[model samples]
Target: MSLLQVSGLTRRFGGLVAVDGVEFNVAEGEIVGLLGPNGSGKTTVLNLLSGALAPDGGSIRFGEHAIHGLAAHRIARLGLARTFQLVRPLGSMDCRDNVIAGLAFGAERRWGSAAQREADDLLARVGLEGRGHAMPGELTYIDQKRLELARALALRPRLLLLDEWLAGLNPTELLEGIKLVQSLRQQGMAILLVEHVMDAIRSLCDRCLVMSAGKRIAIGLPGDVLSDPDVVRAYLGDDHA
Candidate 1:
């Protein structure tokens, strides 16, 4: 069965339809990509899945339960977690403390000392091993991204919704980011990554869903979807795709 399922998801703000009749599924242990142009509604879809926004019409199923209208923290308790496009680590808190914050405020929202052990492990998993006491402001841009991943990992989610995790990193950071996500897949967690970086999508995601104008345009393997002229045009321009 699919680990996460979204069907007929629609959201509207006045006359603007941010997401319209979109349907997709993420299987267990797979890394799936949601790709689209700017203002194409990718982030909005993630927001709905993360329960940050309610859908105008649709159903979201994690495992076998319906979670469309659950509170954001409720959704997290069900093993659904996400990271934002912006890395907002606490400047005063050290790396390990920042990760522990996820347990305090993330899905379950009732974590105690036991979650602290998990927090330490998450730091190592995201390549911040032994850097637990370092302040967020003291870290490099790449380390901040790693810290973000660690924070999300601290939630112990079965399915992760990553919103543009690779947006501002350098080439080296991007490569390392691929390794980070790939390791998640190896550990049997399913990820639905909504990203604009086609290079990362091609390398990391097993399948791709291309969206444009708030609708799904294509769904298939990375190479196949990336080669589609419509997807090309969506990324580059009418003349380029």
Candidate 2:
């Protein structure tokens, strides 16, 4: 069944349409890729789904309830959580504390000592086993990204939105990142990720939704959509296609 259903989703900034009547669905335990070049409104769609930005038109149904204009926290409590393109852990909080915040505020509403224990476990799961005491500023870029994943997972969400969570990494780190995402998929987590790493998308996404100029250009199996002439033109220009 679908965990997220978005129809006629539209968002605008003044006269500029950032996301134009985009529609898609994420099924339970399925990983879907939102693909496009820069400024295709991918992140805007994520923001709207996670309730960071309200859509001017369209409806978002999470599970059975409409959530188009709900507050971000409310959406989190409704089993939807997201990580930003740029990691946004609490600057003043340690790694463990950052995750604790999510557990406390998320769907299950964990708190106190229980939340701390679970936060540390989450940190460990994301390959940050002994780094919970460190501040976000102390982590390397990839470690910080792992922390971001841990924070989102602490929400115990049914559907997770990841915006470029695998953007920058060396070869080895990229491999590890792919493995980490694979582990999440193994655990039956449904994910909608916006990523530019084609290899990662190919390995992780069961389906892809392509966008261009705020419109969905293609939607299908990764191999098919990525090979579509329109998708090729959008990424590499007409010359490469």
Candidate 3:
């Protein structure tokens, strides 16, 4: 069975339909890409899935449970975790403590020294090994992103949702991020990635779902989907048409 199944998922704001009847699935140990241009509803889909926003319609099934309409915290406890397009770390807390909070209260609910050890391991996994004592404001942009990933992993989620996690990285950092994602997949965690970096998408995704104007325009292998005429038109305007 799929780790996550979303069907006819939708959301609206005033007169704008942010996500329209979107549908897709992510299986265990697989990385699925959600590709689209800006305003194409990609992040909205993540929001709905992670319970950051309630859907106006459709179903989200994680395992056997229907997750749409559930409270964010309730949904999180069911083994689903996500990182924001804009990293939001607790600035006042040190890196380790921020992750420790997730370990203590997330799906696993691990606490005390045990949670601290796990948080340390996660920080190391994300390449923030010895920086646990540093404050969020003190770290560089890339380190902050890694901290976000570590916090999400502390949930011990069955499915991980990533939103543009590779947006602002240098070449070396980008390569490191990609490798980290691959390692997570090797460890059997399902990932739904929303990324603008085609190189990362091409490398990490087993299959991709492409969206435009709040609707699916293409779905297939990364190479094929990226080459699709519709996708090209969406990303690069069809002014000649």
Best candidate (score: lDDT): 2
How do these models rank on lDDT, best leading? 2, 3, 1
Worst 10 residues of 1 by lDDT: 105-114
In lDDT terms, how accurate is model 2? 0.94
Q: For residues 1-241, what per-residue lDDT tens digits would candidate 3 score against the true structure?
A: 6989899988999999989998888888989999998999999999999888999999999999999999989888999999999999999999999999888778668888888888899999999998889999999999999999999999888899999999899999999999999999999999999999988998999999999999999998999999898999999989622
The residue-by-residue lDDT of candidate 1 on 72-135, one tens digit each, is: 8888878888888888898889888899888787656646677767788888888889898899
Q: What's the distance in Å from true for residue 187, model 2?
A: 1.3
The sequence of per-residue lDDT tens digits that candidate 2 reaches over residues 68-174 is 99999999999998999999989899999999988888877888889989999999999999888999999999999999999999999889899999999988999
Ranking by TM-score: 2, 3, 1
The lDDT per prediction is: 0.88, 0.94, 0.92
What does candidate 3 score on TM? Answer: 0.97
**Models, CA RMSD each:** 1.8, 0.8, 1.1
Q: Candidate 2 — worst ten consecutive residues by lDDT sum?
A: 103-112
Q: Candidate 3, which segments miss by more than 4 Å at Cα?
A: 239-241
- The model with the greater TM-score, 1 or 3, is 3
